[model samples]
Target: MTTRDPAARLLRLLSLLQSRTDWPGPELAGRLGVSTRTIRSDIERLRNLGYPVAATPGTAGGHRLGSGARLPPLLLDDEEAVAVAIGLRTAAAQAVGGIEETSLRALTKLEQVLPARLRPRVAALAASTVPLPGNGPAVDGDVLTALAVACRDRRRVRFDYHDHKGNATLRDVEPHRLVSTGQRWYLVAWDIDRNDWRMFRIDRLRPRTPMGPSFPGRSLPPGEAIDFVTKGVASTLEPCRTVATVHAPVTAVSERVPPVARVEHLDDQRCLLHIGAAAPLTLAVYLAALGLPFTVDGPPALLEALRRMSQHCAGAVSPATPAMSASQPRADAW
Candidate 1:
């Protein structure tokens, strides 16, 4: 047998233990090409650092991973490695709202350890992905940091929140969580002003420089704070709202309608939908696509606008209709 670096040999043994389900002493000795005596010493070396490798005495059983004093390094298969690589790429793109720089830093660390062959695979995948930002507002880095700190410390924040009509009012709210939907970042908190949970767009925030003192967090909100924030922010725009009586159940409408629209139950098999849009025609068209009967109550202007739009569209033909054949010259006429 060849004599190899004992330390390197031991580390190799540990990697095999972590990777395999079970190994008998003979099998392990055969793989390492070392005597069983050497395997015991190597096992001891792993145990010293908190790995708990258990040896079973039966022919059916061999050596397997037992709970360790502390967790050991993960030995990922090819698929898991690729999944992790893709996740890192996503985070680095900053689709996560406030964690862009931090995600990039973590990504650099991940790239450093990648096996040489896998590194190129990750790079090729990353090259193909691109991000397209939408019309949603972006938050200030400082506000993100400040809110994060407040959430971590269990603090209350007091600030002047500007309403949709651009009315500024003083508020004191218990900071809860920050949520990020693709187009926006939101801070969901118990609005001290309204005494209700409200989701504020991060871009809209002008937090009072020193956030108020720390307080115990409320029972963490029902689901993710982001979802609630998305809902709350959406509900705020109801001034030029459309109140509709739709044939569909509230549940059905809620499921079909986008988060941008609002609906409430009028009764079973029926729902009241309230939606607001900057463009009345656009909103009207979306509701019309539901293919159900609906009655509307709204500003006369919007109702008239929808009426005109309906007339314009009712006479319209499907876009898929092919255009008339291009004109052709006749040789006989020439």
Candidate 2:
């Protein structure tokens, strides 16, 4: 039999090791078309490179890759490779701090090496999808990772946080889960000082790691993590509220409005929309585009903006003269 290159043999051995929980020595040798001795040598080579390949003692024992302090290169199957590449492409479009550029760079590298058959699949999916850019603040990738690690390891973490008012304060918390809402990332944690659960914006967090001691995990709040974060965000809205009664059913209008807005049914045919925006004019424009006739019940500013917009729209449609001579061309004439 022709001798295989040591590098190629080692990579094959590593791939086999990564694909399953364990492989007996003879089975690995048979699969690699090598002797048991070569399998041992290749396993040693992997360990020397910092991949913790562990061997068991009995006849049924084989080798398995064990966890290490640092992440090793992933060996993904075809489906896994496509999934990861697609995920990286999606992450590149989000506002996750410094990682946006990093994700794109990694995706480029991965796509360059994808098998010929898989490359076009990934490219096709990417070409068909369009991701709207998020308007939320960017978060630090390292801080995001640290918090995630703390959550998984059940360790408490300390960080300096700034509130909506930009008031800086120190926080010590037991990290639980990290939630992403496309526009923003949030961390739901148990605040040690306050003795309550709090949802924090990832952008507003500055985690100081060499994290605190581990704590016993507890059940999350009554709702899902996303729900907790949503409620937390809703509580911080500005005072500029816009309430409008729309001539549409609650279900129909609710589907058109953003999840942050409130839709209360006035009856079977009408619903009240409670929305908040920094600018009354912005709210007015959004309401106008809802395609349903609505009456503004407001803080006066939204009403004024809507009224002004209405006048402009009315003037735009009304002709300069009520009567036109037959010789004059009609407005709707081609």
Candidate 3:
């Protein structure tokens, strides 16, 4: 019948509340071995410390944690803690923009508090895994965070954007989501000026201040964010349309062509490649490297480049003198 210490009891109460939603006053008091009045006091104390605890109405009223501005200390079991630590380490190496430092800081703090038994496993995983370098440009971490917050809050944002051609313009949009493509990040937003959805590369965005007033969340454009953003990006690349009849199946040729390229099956052994590149020469080299026979049509320049390259390659392997049979060579200074 002795009461638990105030700090320990409070922590225990918080853990119990976090474990589930809707704990009736009597049930909570019974679990804590305290009076219903004490349970109510503890709920108030949790609220004072920035936890949003809501009370349900009716004869069986209970307390539940609601959304709040500030985050409360999380109650994670041993395995959950390890999973989070590993995820943080992965993010620290792979996250786009300036989030690497922030992730590393979080990871360090998590490792510091991890139980000694779990430390070595986490450390071993961290040491053994090697991250490959990403080719995409680094985006500003603050810009990404701000846009994400605005998306969650259904707020409008304005930013200075430079298009693929390096044209600068100011844009106002209602952000719906931040899509990460492993190498890059994209913002899928409803462009206010254009009256349509548009995708912006996070690295090229220079978000302006005052984020704009809150707006109602808008339904995303008629497809998955990944598909929309990828198609949008393909449309902006340098125009180098080259069509060729490749002597390969559509499946085989497609594996070599850029994802944006269109392929049409002419038959089982031949397919048409409609790809865009910066120039004909670049496209020709790309096709040639696929090791498939292809015939280029249109843009006579591509055919000429291919011919020249073919001759050049032939010359490299050709010998300066014709081959001779053994014993046909003369003595050096006879």
Among the numbered candidates, top lDDT falls to 2
Error of 3 at 257 (Å): 11
* Candidate 3 per-residue C-alpha lDDT over 121-234 given as tens digits, one digit per residue, 9 for 90 to 100: 888988998887778788888888899999989889999999877999999999998887677789999999999988998889899998799898676643567667656655
Deviation in angstroms for 90 in model 3?
2.3
Error of 2 at 290 (Å): 7.1
**Residue-wise C-alpha lDDT for candidate 2, range 271-299, written one tens digit per residue:** 99877666778778778878788887677
lDDT of 1 by residue, 235-277 (tens): 6654456778999787777867766566778888888876766
**Sort by lDDT, best first: what order?**
2, 3, 1
Better of 1 and 2 by TM-score: 2
Q: Model 2 — TM-score against the truth? A: 0.68
Model 1 has an lDDT value of 0.74
Candidate 2 runs further than 4 Å off = 1-9, 24-42, 48-50, 67-73, 221-223, 238-334
Error of 1 at 243 (Å): 4.8
Q: Model 3, residue 3: displacement in angstroms?
A: 10
Error in Å for residue 95 of model 3: 5.0
The window of 10 residues in a row where model 1 has the poorest summed lDDT is 325-334
